[model samples]
Target: MQVLTITTPWFSRAQEICAKKKFDQVWIEIVHNDLEETFLEWVASLSPIRIGMITESLTYSSDVHEKEPTLEERKHKVERRLKYMTHALVCDEKDVGYLKTSSRVLAMWWTPAVPKRFIKRQRKLASLPYGIFIGSVYGERSKIIQNPELKELMIHQQSPEHGTPYPFFFDKMHGALYHFLKSRLPGTKLLFLFYLHFLRAIRQRCFSLWLEALQNGCAVICLPHYVKTYTGRVVEGMAAHMPVITPDIPDRPRNRALFEDGVEILLYPENDPIYLANHIRRILSDPGFSQRIVEKACRKINNFHTCEKRVQQILNWVETGEEPVYA
Candidate 1:
């Protein structure tokens, strides 16, 4: 089968999957930070599978926006291109409604290089002296960081501690620019191309989100996902064998059940920081509990969330037309 993936910035591990799948026929479209797109079409009449995926939405959730020139301006165009793809593979299941065909990769999926020895080491250090929550602070998650326990450990991209990025909070002028660009940019979208160049020139820096994510791989975050993206933050945490605590989404019973309530992950209500705090205290005080949760979570990722395994999922989805059955 000719498998084509139209994705945003590609990862080294994920890029390797193409070589393993089908070498020559794969088409990868690069969209700019959810900001814009570069397009491609089939050189042939038939192509078996075309996947539209943006892992940066999960992997590089923090700094991607700082580098992103204008998401507000480019989102419609970028999203339209993704909508055009044969299969739209979103990192989270909630985003399915917006696209034509959607497949959820589930659980902040990522290509992890975690060593078994590291997990063993973590098991020994089951007190889990340190904890962290890194990434964008979207929705009520801002409130999550305010908890005295989480507040200290929270490392938000928008926070001054890292670097202040003026990404999501756009004004009316920017909004007008988006409307004008979408409506006025015509034909090959020459104006749009120029805009990307201008945007990149001003925004370019030594910022590397993938590197940062790699550096801070051991992070614990739990929240009610209000938006479309659920990054690989959860996977990153588990890869390092850290215990996870987060709010369970009411709609996704399967996701809630992915881990045992206290075994694999600790679930808390969205607005309740007291519950979140209580879970953390329990883990910190109970070394056995933390080890059990971390071990099981790491084992689950080893079985299901690898890059090779995720790619294989799309192939199954295309063949069977059934929801991904996470075991």
Candidate 2:
């Protein structure tokens, strides 16, 4: 199938990946309705077989940005895109619950295992016991991640050193790292874009940055999005063999799908920091327990949610056009 991403934002993102390009998944962002017009115009000229990835930050319930499209407008765009797309991917199983289509594929922001060489290199220079938080920081997203305990953690590292990766407190703070790298490295924009785009997966840059932090031996301090979706950064952390401390991010549809709370991952309550601090303390103080959680998380991620496994699932969906039974 021919993909006309030439004029689309995806084309620019495609330039970053160094790995040989085999897959040609298209993105149909809910935020960028203007791209839909361009994409449709291109599709009209050539019958495009659209395999779209729905954006992860789909908080369509309210308009956060002044220019953000309304839910009805977003839905109309999605339906129009669906008219040409063969399949679409969503962050959660019911993520596209409102979209009127049967081609929806339940995919998290899952990623393949990070290259060991990357992890090995990061560990060599890692400052141990640091925790990294990626994703939005203000308003609702902030409320969810920065409870009393997480706040203290962020404050402790408030004066984050140049290479330090945590307290990535705000949603916008993630870009700071990218800019930092771009300025320091000078002529390696493509390399950063490649990894940022790869995110060790292919969806969001924050996940890739978070994975880099994990590779550096920093623990992941996070909670699932309040949008009832599991941000798959947890999967990346687990896959990287790093300990993950999070709130009770539910495993929907199946048991142990996202996590097993205290087994595959350590769980804390958002309201209480004592539990969060204790979990952190346990990770730092006890080596065996930390190792056990990391091992279990890695096993679950490999068995159920790798970038490879997700791609196969999408392929199977494309052929059958039937949503697989959630395992």
Candidate 3:
């Protein structure tokens, strides 16, 4: 009955979910320095046995708040925390990676489960293009934008306005709205549309950028590398019927398409931006080719391994302590 949830001292959906299931105790694991006792106190208010698992690592003290931790400092801290947890729930690869190396309790990504009705809703919603990507970008890790060709396709123009979230979000929104309205407007100039789309990319987040790009002229989306392992942004994008351009990474055992390469997803040769761009242009130019891709994507989305069916698997994991079966 003693269960522990070890996470950065931030607000966690996993912690709330675990609490709703009534775990006997929930612990928030944090680094030793620059620790917030208030977060621990909040957890204590939620559960009787809340505890803080502080690692032996020297993180930035509040006095050194402006400084970020060195790579070595982070590794040592993570290693120490790995040794501290006996039974724990984890939400990211870093946590899973740590668990794999340590003798700590088994870890789970604690991914969100889709409701049955939501699956049906998503199926209906899938016929239209819908794209979304949440969470901050760690430096140099965006799969699509990092590619020279993909970046050329995705980011039309750069904004000198950096860092502030409000300006970025608003600028993107205005640009998208202008382009969206222009496309519908009876004599909207092509040059005007191009200008709007370029400005949009500079201001919007990843998903919004995707939307704006599609509005201007793009037709396909590459698989987002952002989501954790078990979750499939590819499936979601496919379900929405956007022809997807994905990388052929051998390590990705779960997303291997059972169908032919072009029919399922146009899997490009490893990191060949020219090949990727060529395939992208092919799909955009050929209507029949694009439809086939959309059909295949929708087919894959409808088949087994949907979010709705995964709920039972998640529940089974909570109740019976087993890894959910992948269909």
| Winning model by lDDT | 2
Comparing candidate 1 with candidate 2, which one achieves the higher TM-score?
2
**Candidate structures ordered by TM-score, highest first:** 2, 1, 3
Tell me how far the alpha carbon of residue 110 in candidate 2 is from the true structure, in angstroms, after superposition.
8.2
Q: What is the per-residue lDDT of model 3 for residues 1-327, given as tens digits with 9 covering 90 to 100?
A: 343323232132324434455544555555443433454444555644432333222222343333344645664654555443444444343455456566545554343232222222222222222222322444323554466665545443222233446576666655675565546544334434454465445534444433333322334444423323333445544544566666564444443533357786777654466776777668656868877877765665556445565545544554577865443
Q: Write the per-residue lDDT of candidate 1 for residues 245-297, one digit (tens) a residue.
A: 66765555545555677878777777887787677667657778877888888
RMSD (Å) of each candidate, 1 decimal: 11.1, 8.4, 14.1
| TM-score, one value per model | 0.57, 0.61, 0.48
Model 2 spans > 4 angstroms off: 1-38, 44-48, 57-80, 100-127, 140-210, 215-218, 223-227, 249-256, 269-272, 322-327
**lDDT by residue for model 2 (1-327), tens:** 543233232333323432334444454543354554554555433323455566543444444444344645665566566656655666544555544334344333322233322232122234456466655565444554556655544322221222533323332334654564446544444544554443323233444454555555356766534434555556666766787776663434432355677788877665456677778777767878877887777666656665556656666776666654333
Q: Which pairs in model 1 have colliding backbones? A: 108-232, 222-246
Candidate-wise lDDT, in order: 0.50, 0.52, 0.47
Candidate 1 lDDT trough over 10 residues, lowest sum: 103-112
Compared with the true structure, model 2 gives a TM-score of 0.61
lDDT assessment of candidate 1: 0.50
Candidate 2 weakest lDDT stretch, 10 residues: 115-124
Off by over 4 Å in 1: 1-38, 42-48, 54-79, 95-130, 148-219, 223-230, 319-323
